[model samples]
Target: MQRKNSILRSSKRGGFAMIMAIILIVVLTTIMALTLSLTSQTTKQTSDLYLREQAVLLAKSAAELALLKVSGWNRATSGCLTSVNAVYPSTTNKIFDINVTMKYIGLGCGGSADYIPAIVTPESNGTVLMDVTVTSDPGVSTEPIRYFRRTLQKL
Candidate 1:
């Protein structure tokens, strides 16, 4: 009788251990799945952030370039280059499209420029408003990224 009781107790303990093991495996598997999901989400967010930062930087640089063009322009000699458009790399795998438009304030660009001064005020004369827009190419970027920067420069 003693030997039989011992055997029964041992069988019960073995069954309990197997149940515990299964529970532990299920918990661990759940944790692993959650971790993988979070990791993929983080990667996608990082990629989007990087792309947006690039677009913002490109817009800023484009604004500066527009300012440079305005500074070098001789109003008396020729019409101002009111608008500029070009791809960043000018390559087949182009990633960025930058567009810049300019408006003169305070001066009458009357017939002198293809872009007439949008705002003509005595106080704002010799001032320029440059709008620069940068967009990630749809062909390359999975997520759309667009950035616009406006600069008011006194020339």
Candidate 2:
């Protein structure tokens, strides 16, 4: 009887060990899968953030270019320099679309009434209201990114 009882007890222990091993394997697999999923999501988020930052930088550069253009504008010309649009890099493969819109305030530039009242501020002479928009084109970017910047610059 003792021998038989020992044999039964050993068999039960082996079965329990097998079951525990299977559960442990399942838990480890789940953890690994979750980790892989998180890693992929992090990669995508990082990519998106990088693209957005690039767009913002491009917008800022476009704003500066707009300022330069306005400063060079012939003030004697009755028409205010209103809009400018160009693409960055100018390569065969275009990357970003930049659009700059300017509104002027005070004298010399068309009485300033040609600009919308909401855009022009009173007593702000020689101020160039620069609105810059930079958009990532579909040719290279995985997703479309657009950044807009408004600047008040003294000409």
Candidate 3:
């Protein structure tokens, strides 16, 4: 009788240990799943931030280029303000577009005033607004990363 009782008690202890091990395994698996989910979200946010930064830089560069062109504008060189130009970067895989326009002022003497010294006529000065877009292709998802920006030349 004594031996039989000892065996029964041992069996009970073993069963309890097996149940605890299973529960621990389930808990660990839950924690791992949560960690993986959070990591994925963080990675996506980082990628988006990188793309946006690139787009902004491209926009700023285009704006600066437009400003330079406008500053160099002269009636003798460009002939007229209605003329414009588009410039593209000459780098490998460089994806940016730049467009510029111009305006000028002309003097006139046809006003209601008794004797107008001069009249100011607005001529199209070459100033441009630039749009920049960036894209990143991540193979994991069906959608690709995209960023857009709009910037105008400084007066």
Best lDDT goes to which candidate?
A: 1
Give all candidates' CA lDDT scores: 0.79, 0.78, 0.50
Question: Predictions ranked by TM-score, top down?
Answer: 1, 2, 3
Question: At residue 94, what lDDT does model 3 achieve?
Answer: 37
Cα displacement (Å) at residue 83, model 3: 11
Q: Which regions in candidate 3 have their CA more than 4 angstroms from the true location?
A: 1-8, 73-155
* Candidate 3 Cα RMSD after full superposition onto the native fold (Å): 8.1
* Structural similarity to truth (TM-score) of each candidate: 0.78, 0.73, 0.54
Give the better candidate number (1 or 2) by TM-score. 1
TM-score of 2: 0.73
Candidate 3 lDDT tens digits, 1-155:
45465666676898899999999999999999999999999888886666556656655665566556556656365443332333334434333333433332231212321122323433322223444444443442334645555554433
Residue-by-residue lDDT tens digits, candidate 1, 1-155: 45455666676898899999999999999999999999998998998898889888888888888788888888777756678787877767788999998877755666534234555445666787788888888876567888888888787
Q: What are the runs in model 2 whose C-alpha is more than 4 Å off? A: 1-5, 8-10, 75-78, 107-113, 116-123, 138-143
Model 2: how far is 30 from its true place, Å?
0.8
Candidate 2 vs candidate 3: the TM-score winner is 2
Model 1 residue 124 CA deviation (Å) reads 2.7
Give each model's clash number.
0, 0, 12
